[model samples]
Target: MRVALLSDCYLPRLGGIEVQVHDLARSLRQAGHEAVVVTATQGPDEPIDDVPVERLAIPLPGGVPVNPLAPPKVRRLLLDGGFDVAHVHMGVVSPFAMDSMRVALGVGIPTVATWHCVLAHAAPLVDAAGYVERWADRGAELTAVSQVAAAPLRRMSGGAPVSVLPNGIDVARWSPGPRPEASTGSLRVVTAMRLALRKRPLDLVKVVARARELAPGADLRLEILGEGPQRRRLEAWSARHGAQEWLSLPGRVTREELHRRYLASDVYVAPAELEAFGIAALEARASGLPVVGPRRSGITEFVADGRDGLLVDDDEQFAQALARLATDADLRDRLGAYARSTPVRQDWGEVVAQTVQAYGRARA
Candidate 1:
């Protein structure tokens, strides 16, 4: 089947939902299904890609234009493009999202959607709440990344056919085989995310810094990955605090290198207060590392509390969890094993196949 995967973001930019959309599109194509992605991007579309791409323009805060939204032309293009299924990543459902839904209905094609990001933070309730409702009756099926995210998105969609299809980790590419183990006797903790206030990258740094204070000679190493709008502010803040020594800012990492870091690291910590789904945490777990995710938000749907990894509600508790995992090798090994089992049944082919089935049902 030919599928049109629509999104507000795509490759060249690094984001959880963006990664999942691109990966799913690639998997669909690999599975003998033709897939095209329509995304909002700055400047001209680049030529380095195996899949066909359509770029859209987005409005900015001031005179400067932002590439975070797809233009109306996206709907026209998708309509003209021959496709069997219209699978859209409604992470930040915008005017384009509504248009896409309308187009699918007009073209008499089955429409499916994935609830990726928490919409409440992205825009007003009118767009976040009612827009999905307008498209809910139109959608054949809607899926959320995690069950926790489903409630909010479902409520927004007026209780559409919402299912929880947790994102899976590419365990083979992210295993420790590619990267060399740390030769030294230090516990390394890595945090991967765009440095945004919602992600709270600085909070992770503070937690690690506090952990270092408690275990003065524990030899804790911190690796901070990814870049974002808050780069300058975060860098200066890191300098002010004692976190500068332990913290290594490597900017954005490629998928291959990211997996290597995951394999080489001793621990993966996600301090996101507003995480829609912790895909990075899954990758870390798949790499045989224990996770440190907060008990709140969508991550709680996975990162099993106490069994597979630590889930803390506060900084004090999170710091304690980090200290405990750092000191206990057996605990790390046991939890890592459990983490691997968490998504053992998930496969790209299986996910795409299920999606195809949903599209078929949507048509009926």
Candidate 2:
């Protein structure tokens, strides 16, 4: 199969959707299908990691991904490229991806559109626009990153089937060979997320602060990885709370570095309640760290409460759970052991197979 993977985001930028779309294209090629990335994200047409990239980007201030003049170029490509399928990846507000979807369908190419964001915050605007419902009516196959993300799409589609096409990870690559024993008695808690407001990065600091107050002598330490707009706010919060000694905000690090940190850490905390699918949490779990996160979010797909890790309903409960895990080595070990033993179902092989199935449905 010759597939064109379209997205408003791609390599040279790092985020959930960008990373997943790139990985999905690579996975397809590895499975013996020819996959090319057609992105509006500002980057060269050169192949990234041996997979071809087609950029329809228009220069804009702040390097915005939207390309107003991309429709004709996208239609021409789909018409002339002989693409077997056009797989469109969308975030909550992806105008470029949306435009690509329309162009692909207008050119009569088989198209699969996958949503990578939770729609709770954008439901009203999306509902009012009715683009998704109309797309469903026009036979554009729809999928989402997780069941949590699919719920609103299903509702808006007015009974169209919304499948769950999850994000993929390299499980073996992430698996820690042997966790290094902690030389210091201090417990390390780690989290990786773009320091954005929606991700609730500051909430992690508050949770840790409250946990320290709850377990005054537990020697708990936190390391938040990843850089974003919330860095200054987090720094000021840490300073005001006198948490510099216990809290460390080391900006984004390489994946290998993250795996090393996970191996050295005791637990991973995901503070976002609206997380569609916690990829960072999954990576930590793959590296043999127990995950602590909300029960209602997509983290529940893999992090089973009381089995894989502990789940909390509110900030107070999150703090209490962190304190309990910090104080109880046995519980931490148990959860981490389970996390290591149980392989995630979102491995690239499984995800590639699912992608093939979605393509089949789109073609049908």
Candidate 3:
């Protein structure tokens, strides 16, 4: 089955969705299926790693690197050959999705779309009523990354069932490995996320600062991973909040380096007020580290409070949870030990099988 995977974000952009799309497409190809990626082009002669890429015409605000448009030739090819499946990622009623849908439906192609971003975060981009009507009209099988992602997506489905599929990690690539790096005397707690406002990287800063005051002797050091526009602001805040001495800002890590960092760190902390699903936290858990994150939204589906990890509500509770993990090595070890035991959505192999199955379904 020839399957086309479409996403707004891809490699070099650096985000959870982008990473997920790349991994999923790669897994699909490895499984012997033709999985091609259709993404918004960054610009002329953009270096897109090794993936096969086609450019779209979507405009970006301030010429930001987002290309969410579709070219006619790609559309003609998708329609002419009748792609078994058009698996779209995180597309709402946006122009890109609308254009893609025109080609999909014109060729009598069955489409499956995965909801990646949390609905609340996507409110500004999607037209709720128009989106639902369009989604229902488009006639596509819908799947969401988690139950948290499923809720808001339910509205768009009308009466269609939304499959709760998880975004998977390449277990072999993202597992706990090496002898692990020592955080010196500090019980290392790391937060790996883009420095975006919605990600609330500042929340990590605030929580780390508070933890320093509450649990000074714990020798806590927080590694803020990933890069974005807010790097300077986060660094400045770390200084002003007195977490500078121990807080390290290591911007952006590759897949290999990220997994290594996970192994090195004792705990993974995410202060995102809104998280579609905590992929970073999952990677951390896969690397045998307990996670500290919020209770509400998609994160709860993976993070079981007091079990694999601790889930809190606000900044105050986030600080408390980190402090608890920092002070109790035995408990952190216990949680980390069990953290890896939690089942994930797609173990590369399963992702392959399910994707092929979706292609079959699309054909039928």
Candidate 4:
């Protein structure tokens, strides 16, 4: 099958959806399908993992970094791409993605629209937008990364079937490996996520600080990986809390380095409350790291409370969980073993197979 993966963001941009688009395209191609990525992110023509990418020139409105492109260009691309099916990854506020979906359906192509965001507070607005887009075309199939993300859309779709298709990670690439022991005599707590407002990176600093206070004589070190608009604020917060020596914000690192960090770390902390499908937490668990995150979010889909890992309610509980994991190596090791053994999701090949089934349904 020839597939066109459309998105508002792509490579060189560090985001969860961007990574998912790239990985999905690659997986599709590996499954003997011709896959191409269409994006409004302006960049030089590049091939990610042998998948061809077409980057269209689009203007950023109101000085915002989002790619809001002209609909005509998207229509022309859909018409000219010669793809058998179109898979559009929709963001919470993605004008480009919606435009692509409309154009793909306008061209009478089988289209699969996958929602990748959890619009917690703005869900009503998103549902309103969905209602507005209801006139476009109803033939296209709909999916979401999690039930939390699918709720508002399903409500707005007026009973249109919205399938839940969670994101997949390259478990083999991120598999467990021998990690060098930490030189610093401290419990290593690691989290790799875009330092955004929804992620609550600043709150992570407070959690780490409170954990240090609760665990007397226990050295708790936090290593935050990934970069975003909140980097400066998080840095300032780390300094303000007098955790500069213990907390290190190394920004984004290479994929290999990330896997190594996960293997070496004692605990993985996910502070994001609105994660549609905590891929980072899954990767950490695959790397044999015990996860500590909120129970209400999508991380609950994988991280089992009091079994594979510990799930908390608020920042206070999060801090206490961290402190307990930091002080007890036996508990950490046992939880880590359980985390590695827990069956979360299928591999990329199986995910691609499921996606192909969705495409077949869209075409039928």
Top lDDT prediction, candidate number: 2
TM-score, structure 2 vs. true: 0.96
Worst-scoring 10-residue span by lDDT in model 3: 62-71
Q: What lDDT tens digits, residue by residue, belong to model 2 across residues 43-100? A: 7778998999999999988778998899999999889998999999988889889899
Q: Quickly count the clashes in candidate 4.
A: 0
**Residues 148-184 of candidate 1: C-alpha lDDT, one tens digit per residue:** 6676666666766688766655556655443444433
- CA lDDT scores, all candidates in order: 0.71, 0.89, 0.72, 0.82
Clash count list over all predictions = 0, 0, 2, 0
Decide which is better by lDDT, 1 or 2.
Answer: 2
Candidate 1 lDDT score at position 60: 57
Residue 363 shift from truth in candidate 2, angstroms: 0.8
Off by over 4 Å in 3: 43-50, 58-74, 91-94, 121-128, 178-186, 340-345
Candidate 1 residue spans exceeding 4 A from truth: 42-48, 56-76, 120-129, 178-186, 337-344
- Candidate 2 global lDDT: 0.89
How do these models rank on lDDT, best leading?
A: 2, 4, 3, 1
Measured on C-alpha atoms, candidate 3 has an lDDT of: 0.72
* Model 4 segments more than 4 A misplaced: 59-69, 130-137, 179-186, 342-346
